[model samples]
Target: MAQSSSKRIFLCNSCGNEYFKWHGQCPACSEWDTLSEFHPPKSRRKSNGAPARKTTKLHTITHKKDRKRTSSGINEVDRVLGGGLLPGSMILLGGQPGIGKSTIAIQIVAGCGKSALYVSAEESEDQLALRAERLGINTKNLHVSGENEIMNVLEQVSVVQPSLLVIDSIQTVYNEDLDSLPGSVSQIRDCGQQLLNACKQKGFTVIVIGHVTKIGTIAGPKMLEHMVDTVLYLEGDERYDHRILRSVKNRFGATNEVGVFHMTSAGLEEVTNPSELFLAERTANTAGTAILPTMEGTRPILVEVQALVSKANFGTPQRNTNGVDSRRLSMLLAVLEKRLGNFMGMNDVFVNLVGGLKIQDPAADLSIISAVASSSKDNVIADGTVLVGEVGLTGEVRSVARIDQRLQEAAALGFKIAIIPKGNMKNVKSFKGLKIHGVKSVREAFQIIF
Candidate 1:
């Protein structure tokens, strides 16, 4: 029989609550019965076979074979990953369900499709094969598994010894060494660590798929994110099939790069020209719609904004928006009604990003203001016109950051008119092809565009 020590029940590390015994839950926190009995550590496992590594000079560190990048068979993905996949690098790709996470991975492994081993903890072999068939990815070197056991993966690693290793999901993976069930913090951390160790020891590239929590952060403990070499987040409205993959952390490349993908019947298609997708749906000569050019990471793309105004029956009007912050919408409304005398307080206002894309850039200010004004006056702007600038609360148009990049994007998309900040004209290297009209205030911008 096990002896009890001083009736020493441990409190949850997350929430301070007393437990009579070690349990999976705390009566106070109500946190998935997460209360676990705390016991003194039996021992820490230490490795003894490897020689200690000495710190090398910076120039010498660049000569290693493992530092070289290998292509993932996808150009756009490679660009987002900073040239290509680095050997011994473990990347975590996360997204919501049905967001095509698996499709992207399958495409990535296609380059070495005939020379890699893929251990999928989430789906069985038959299901993976069916997906590959449907997607027309008949690669020779690819292997799939439904097993979640970590020991099985270790054995697979020994036999396959492929150039790349791919895991469908980190959540479904488990290790028999730990008594806790799979998908727990300890299990995920252990599994991720083991896989990373295997990759480094064998000199291979690895990719893991993770599911995002409700808060839009990756699931599992925060430490799991830190353990990976790079972290990529896939976000977009599920309603529209357009997805954006942004690099949040990269040990070897620029962190502010992004890759755009459009969901189609064939598979996830790489978006070569992102500008067309955002502005192609715009109606020519529409008053309540305006085009804005913004950059995600380093990729510049054009987007459109739309607004609608209707009379309010109740004393106060309702303000609603999609793809923009609700609190920011309220502040903008207050500014328009107070500074411009727009009489919008008694009207219902609706704002949308149009393509199911979420943009939180102040550079969209000019387009947003024009959209609101158009809705109020029921007047449409011009065809092939794009607006980019920040609008102050006093109805002044302020200069935005990276105006040149935005202009080049709009010009690339074949937009004819650009209503931009007056201050940007001086800094532009050359405006040879663009018709830019600079404005200092909201009134000036409206007058120039209309």
Candidate 2:
């Protein structure tokens, strides 16, 4: 076999396109100033004629009995993983610097209850030990190392032969063969590929911690995300103690699954019932407030939607929202003004979802409109009332998916009344201690609530 010489090339960080020369704009993605220098590893070729690779028929391949998933010892973590962690799978955990990425990673490693190696490229062994102690983890099976060299780390892995391997971060480790510095596009791609290969061959689970860019995406080429088996993100506001662990991509589990946690003095504690936690501090019988039953993956949760409308202070009415889509709020406001009257056009509107949860459920559309209308009219929605439906452009209340599940969750939380889309009424089986009101239009809903 002969090794081919490696060449320096340019790569677009946005689209992962290769270029022989640097350009201000990437030709593939049309993104400006996203190209960076990269050195691809040398390739090996056989001196003699190449032989055909072996192949196996898909139907003939049998599943291994020992390939079953094992619990990570954390119920919330296992839930996001669709039950448990599978052996030989590569997972990526990414989040902001202080948003508890390392905390959760260490917790998972400690809870795996197996011989594990923790490779920390950015922290010392002492720092890791302190963190483990603070989290009340005292396990002899977990080994800590401060190596950042990719080859040396692999050598340690070979020596340890542990069932689990964790890389504190993918950005700080670099391959010696590549001239690019650590965290560079070339280093991340090459090192990540090497880890993936090792995970597949050695049959040990690997969890790689990755940093996110300012835009909240994992920092690296888009291909890096495609190389992992699962991608989890830790998100929360610095001002709040609530944290959300969400799965955006998963090969074995359903995506968009979320696990709620609260930051405590000791460590992150899982919230068993997020609905109760989110509505714990609700002000009863308050104007500009509505309850919405939304679904996160297969779990149904009730979140509070609040809105405030005031007279415009400036030339134009100010429209601001937190944890709610700005465009959706604008459209809802327009609907309220056109369908109802010009009340909102002359007022400033602000809508916020309690508990720092950002929801994309269209079932919240009716809730948002209800809250906004309640604030504008200075009237409070009745106690123990929840709204679930999608508001269309023509002010018609549209049906939402999983209406039965949403209503059942609301009912379990002691919600006495529910305003749902008329189209979904047939799907409701009726629950004890709860009353359902079906509305055909937003006007009808207002008439009933007011």
* Among all candidates shown, the one with the greatest lDDT: 2
In order, candidate lDDTs are: 0.78, 0.89
TM-scores, one per candidate: 0.86, 0.94
* Model 1: per-residue Cα lDDT over 91-128, one tens digit each: 99999888888888888888644367778877888888
How many times do residue backbones clash in model 2? 0
Candidate 2: clashing pairs of residues: none
Q: What lDDT does candidate 1 reach at residue 83?
A: 88
Q: Over all chains combined, what TM-score does candidate 2 have?
A: 0.94
Q: Where in model 2 is the C-alpha error above 4 Å? A: 1-6, 42-54, 60-63
- Scored by lDDT, model 2 comes in at 0.89
| Whole-model lDDT, model 1 | 0.78
Backbone clashes under 3 angstroms, per model: 12, 0
After TM-score superposition, the amount by which residue 247's alpha carbon in candidate 2 deviates from its true location, in angstroms, is 0.4
